[model samples]
Target: MPEFAISADPIFGTYALWVGTLLAIAGVILFVLGTLLKRDVSQVWLTYRGWLIMIPTLFGTVMLGRTASVLGVAALSVVSFKEFARATGLYKDWWHTCTVYLGIAGLAIATLLPDPTTGANGWHGLFRTMPVYVIALLMIIPVIRNKTDGQLQQVSLSIVGFAYMGWMFGHLGFLANSPHFHGYVAYLIFAVEINDIAAFTFGKAFGKHQLRSNVSPSKTVEGALGALAVAMALPWVLHFSFPHFGTTELILTGLIVGIGGQLGDLTLSFIKRDLGVKDMGQSIPGHGGFLDRVDSLIIVGPLFFHMDRWFHGI
Candidate 1:
């Protein structure tokens, strides 16, 4: 039998039971809700709510391990970058779209390949290969361009779109490979979800001052504080429950991750406002799109990665 089966903590067993129950319940509810309502739920609600269910479920199933989680993250990056490119009106050529997708596919495959035994250098080899793929696409842009007006604008947008959505999200693999993978992933999810939940609950109850009506009308100062409070409180709770994370460390991690999560939300909102769209896409019934759900994670992952490295000596 596997060692995990005989572990005293029953970590896997307990997690499976709870996760299965929740997913079954959620699946039924979503099905019923969709049928009864006969109308799709808000994208924001669907995206966040789905992740609230899916992330933990995946974690419990052992599918949320470093390798699997990073692959999921990379897949999301591809979707988001594709949407972003379309929104920004970049890559008019079919060839350009194909090229970008090909590069993304290559990166995704690289993620699933067995980790090289050459230590850090092996990882570096993977990273180096990604740029070469990207460069190949970049090199072909000139060949595809048909001397259209504002050529520079199109190329610039394409580059920025890829870098922001693809390159940045690819860093998830790097973070997953870090020493503090467990802590970092946990902290990232906790911070992002807690902050969003706290903000919404607080804003609804006692949001007198608007934070940004232009971008996100519902955001408020009260909600922001509420988020910060919960963000700060999580560390203390973790300390008491786990006894492994220290008080000072938790507090600092909470503050950084919480603030970063909020900023990410705001940034995404700004993008939506500029595009004059309500949600990113309709992939998830109530949720807008995968990008909408993982917007905060995009920022939180990198921030938490570096912070964990600094504090936990990872």
Candidate 2:
């Protein structure tokens, strides 16, 4: 991989610029149309403004360098886990919570090692092995605390929490370590966000059938199908990132990201429903919380990363 520099990968920069430009154009359109209809555009502007900050921060962090990108992912994982803990009231057990954060931070740091191609770049060996250590530590935590009561709930929650935010999001960070880190990292994340918008747009226009009325009523069959279509079709357009991908492979990749993205979203919805609350937090103005904005991306990283690894050996 070339050294992580903004100009090192022109293709990545091109696509990143386009993503921001397109959003800007859409914002202008939304603002104009809302004004004509005498509707409040404040919500639209709030979301537009949020993306204005998020797009560069997200794309630039990855563009500046490797370690910056990896650490950025680590920061997101920690914040996301914090949101999850707060929502579930899991923050009460600070020990278990901090442990999970430590696991995620470890995963992020592991990616900083240069790939030797023959030995441990930490992906196959230590990355896989460290989780076992985390598991053992989780078991030992309760013994040290000597709190038998609620041990079951705390331990289980910690294990799953680490698996969810720490493990899953860690996979996303690992993409930065891939040989094609220049393009692949940005492409993987950018696609998921697009799939989300496609689902919401299609759902509003022709969403008569509810995909899961109980779990997420706002989601519609139309939206899900739209997401699938976008996922399945997007790779052909982005084939420049990986010319090695044949049509079949691209389709599979799309299916993984598209369906996986919705599943990720629905998974968060499942959690919220079980908790009998709406929106994870109020961080974003028009959007719910930071977690709400990224719910679609939670499972997408692992699903896409593994699929890409399997087919393209990335």
lDDT leader: 2
Candidate 1 per-residue lDDT, tens place, 1-314, comes to 11122143343344445546866786667666677776574553465476676666656433345556567666777788777766666645555556666666666666555557743311535653676667557656766675656656655655655555666566665565654454455545655777898999999999999998898888999999999899888867544323455666677678776787787788889988998877777776666676787787767665665565566533
List, residue by residue over 1-314, the lDDT tens digit for candidate 2.
55566677776877877887898788778878787777787777888888888878987788776678788888887877887788877889898988888888788767776446765343545665667978888888889998888878888878877888777777877777676776676677778888988999999999999999999999999999998998888888888876777777788778878888899899999988997778877776777777787776668787777777787665
lDDT for model 2: 0.79
Note the Cα lDDT for every prediction shown.
0.65, 0.79
Model 1, 255: alpha-carbon shift in Å? Answer: 1.9
Quick one: RMSD of model 2? Answer: 2.2
Error of 1 at 79 (Å): 1.2
Model 2, residue 166: C-alpha shift (Å): 0.7
Q: After superposition, how far is residue 258 of candidate 1 from its true place, in Å?
A: 1.2
Clashes of each: 5, 0
Clashes of 2: 0
